[model samples]
Target: MQNPTAATLYSQKQIPIGLKNTIDKTLSEYLKDEKLASYNIDNLKQIIEDSKINFNIKTIKWDEDGSEKSTSAEVASILGMILTFIIYMFIIMYGGMVMQGVMEEKTNRIIEVMISSVKPFDLMMGKIIGIGFVGLTQVFLWGILTTVLVSGSLFFFGGNTSPEDMVAAQMAAQGVNNVAAGSSDISIQVQEIINSINFGMIGTSFVLYFIGGYLLYAALFAAIGSALEQQEDAQQFMTPIMLLMAFSLYAGIYSMNNPDGPLAFWCSMIPFTSPIVMMVRLPFDIPVWELALSFALLFATALLIIWFSAKIYRVGILMYGKKPSIKEMIKWVKYK
Candidate 1:
């Protein structure tokens, strides 16, 4: 009954003789009398509850945690759209960096001197990383600002929603009749959609996918910039990457229509497109094994692309007479 006795009893190598005897007596007494069994179970529950009691009990919201299950499809759909918008904005932002970097080097004729001082790969990497950090810093600042705005809006609008509103919403969806005559169908659908979205998966997939996708394109853009000695020369190379990015983005949008379809599965599995495709599918569900495999593929593809791009970058930085054709670029990829 006391803490010290309970601790000692628990710490024993084997159940102590006295405690075993007490348990045997209790079980025997309970078994012999039907009324005593109910009383015994109640007493045991009380004892366990008393022993385990803590401040956590006061804060526990068992009703919510243990409450009804909900789908996250609607939320996933919303997040996918938001992510698509952000990705395009990112392309415009960082892709502009590639063009600007090319223009800067061309104007200063610094590309000539830089190639002599450092390996083209190093210069390209350093420039890309430095610029990428700037972009990331801007993004982080924007996120913080947005969060503050949202919180402010919620506060100003009194986001303190009533529990009855939640209950009524849930009940109406389940067809609990005559609960609320005035509840809007739009509100109910919105709540259902909001409830369907899996926030955890959406957030996780978004972070990983966006970062991977960005790194992949950023490296490609940097390599492209390194290859061009003039802004005009860069345009020829720019179209293809732009097309790839646009195609991948559009493919992601198409995949959203059928999150669980075969095309979506393959699209999300491909590292180049997965960032957008997987984010779109997060609302439906991504299997753990599939996600892992997709990640592995993405990492491997990134490494390979960076390696080949570095090779291209090595020769490309020094190239100045004229723009390299596709054939010449292929030679760089295979060069020792």
Candidate 2:
């Protein structure tokens, strides 16, 4: 009898049936002797039938609305995660740009000249808003360009193949049809998954969170820049801010795995971490009330942070030659 190889097992149709037939033929021939021939054929048939089987498993998930296929959920989860990471990186990158620009102006003594004409609050708000708009413009352009390129590619190359067909082809290439009905079910639901995503909600929430999160952190970053006479002096103040951002990142990651967990719920509520965490959770079925509350808290907190940062910025920008301690910063905040 020929032994089945990996290629034959995965690539061949009716694999178990073919193997059983071959085994039966081989066994009958080998047992042709009278002593073996006396054995019960019924028993042998039962054994062969019992052994002739293949496994194909499928998982069906149910949400509050109705039954959900795993493939659709997986696709949504992946897209949400990618967007979350992109937003997180963008906030950090652009926030740092604001800090660096402020430091450069201060270093060159250009701020003194600028300040001669402008109030510190106005100057600080101008820099923050200007840099933030630049970041937002870049993000908007990137979104538009990405959409155009992706749509063009799909139109040019995607051809008549439906999403299901595409998924089936990919699975067939890998030779693993573990899903039920040989990927047919998953393929059928691909369009449904695509349609289920709330692109409008995501886009709106992303823009709001991106701006809110960036403004919240950028104010503090600008305050840090104003306090330090040299670049090195910024490090001591920046460490705590960096750690808070890092915590938000980790919280976002955790939310990806457990979107409805208590940790994710609280993270999405906190102003410091909500920007990243809430965005991560938005793709899922979070309640309207929770989202509304999170937004309100974040908006209020951003205003409070900006007000506090302005106080620090006014005093810190003028002080020179010596690095101020946390105690001294409090005194600056208290100064009328």
Candidate 3:
């Protein structure tokens, strides 16, 4: 009973079938030995202890200084991915809101009265900017509230160890030493990863991507809304935009796994996909010029989209009951 293996197994409420079989086979083989046939349980325990092998593993991480270093790059990657997805969802949700608002206003003939004073382009820009501000405010509040809640929880519950460590400690207390030990190692690794992140840089990048991504898409959504006479008719125009956004989301996911891959590099540079893809790459060692170029392209593309969408919006806002085809839409762009 004092045998470590036996004691550990006995402590469990239910031994796994495979483990029980292993114990049975090991004891049977030990007893089959002619030298151990007459030995009692205590002597057999000693033999088992003497025959046991212990494996100890140590990991070393090296830095540029030839010294050992621990990094949180994985942690930063995870956080970056989470922020990327959040930004993706925010843009889509807010962009849709803009579209629906425009559709509702046009449906109620409210845009007619408003446009009498405000030019069509001004009205469209105002709607896009106003909704963008609302989205930013919501995200800002959410960030603040999440930070406060996490800080408060940590302050009250002890911030020294992470949640994994707490669970490991509980497991150790309950006699699951092996499980607890494994979890403790994982907890240490997680802490190291968390320590390596640059939250300031990530926060700044997230804000820029979030805004840039939203503006680019919202303009198109507004144009779609204006071109449609009814909310249901917006589907035809919405499909391509939605598909593009979906592709960006998938690209962002792919970039998380291969941040430096060619797919990520090109996608991150592209204006349509840059918002999500660049965010996924930002936590890593991306070059400043590439980031700047992406931003420049995104802003430039947004301006171009707004200019083009404004023309469509100006012509379509007054046209009701007829859903414009692609050819007709192109002609609308040529209108003075």
Candidate 4:
């Protein structure tokens, strides 16, 4: 028996004990015939005797283990990946502001005067954080806009892109489309993939990796901004960091195309590459150990980069009117 759909706001006194007992009895009667049902008349009897089911809040909260399938995880994972990509692109796209701000200060000769008043490190930190906050504000706006658009699209369109389409594309690419056509095995494969995407893990991991990746890249960008006197001067130094990010992105994408392949496995394990790789793997099955190891490595790497960047930033801010070469960067990196 289904409960009434209408909302009934009942007060604490004069509780509907009789009505509640009748409902419980009905549920017990219905469940008793189903041998598969774990709940029985005894449980219902207790509720009826107690005149309140409130004591079993913990039981009510308990759910079947591993009940969540991979489809939800996959969506969460993809959403995270998309969100991370957008944020990453935005940071890289506008990171020039940090460089430009520094250059502007130097060009106006204001930096020299400011140095008289404040330490170079303080000025550099202030400029980096200030410009970073601006970038963050822009990104926050973009996130809100993107969220609205995606919600609208899914609601209106039912988000029709299904695993079948991806599977078909894969089959067609492999020249197995004709063979997979009208095959029950293809159905099973599709179902397995659908089940493997764990939305919960994907969502959690996406949020973590996205924030972590942004902070990691932003710190590096800030360092680059400090190292260069002008926007143009940043190119030589920025290239390596840019390449690292680009390569990591491509590797993650390529891994998504072949999730179980060696490339995906290796790339996902690498700290620098895991954010993307793990995102792609979220739609598939990844080991717990791999995720843990990747996170540890990335965290350690981020700390090291921050320390190194801060050191370079301290020196580069005061050195003006000269272009920095890779050779000079080696010296900065080597400074004890």
Could you tell me every candidate's TM-score relative to the true structure? 0.65, 0.72, 0.71, 0.56
lDDT of 2: 0.78
User: What lDDT does candidate 1 reach at residue 114?
Assistant: 73
Query: Model 1, residue 1: what's the lDDT?
Result: 18
Per-residue lDDT tens digits for candidate 2, residues 67-173, read: 56443556557777777788888887888877888778877889999989999999999999998999899879977986686466445444356766766676676
- C-alpha positional error of residue 233 in candidate 4 after TM-score superposition, expressed in Å: 2.7
Candidate 3 local lDDT, 14-126, one digit each (tens): 77799889988887566455445455465775787789999855444554588643465565577768888898899999999999999899889999999999999999999
Cα RMSD (angstroms) for every candidate in the order listed: 20.1, 12.1, 10.8, 21.6
The TM-score of predicted model 2 comes to 0.72
Which candidate should be chosen as best, given lDDT against the real structure?
3
Evaluate model 1: give its lDDT.
Answer: 0.67
Task: Please give the TM-score that candidate 1 achieves against the real structure.
Answer: 0.65
lDDT per residue, candidate 1, 111-213, as tens digits? 8887777877777677767776776776667667756865564444333554357556656665544434334433443444454455556655655665666
Determine which window of 10 residues in candidate 4 has minimal summed lDDT. 55-64
Highest TM-score among the candidates is held by which one? Answer: 2
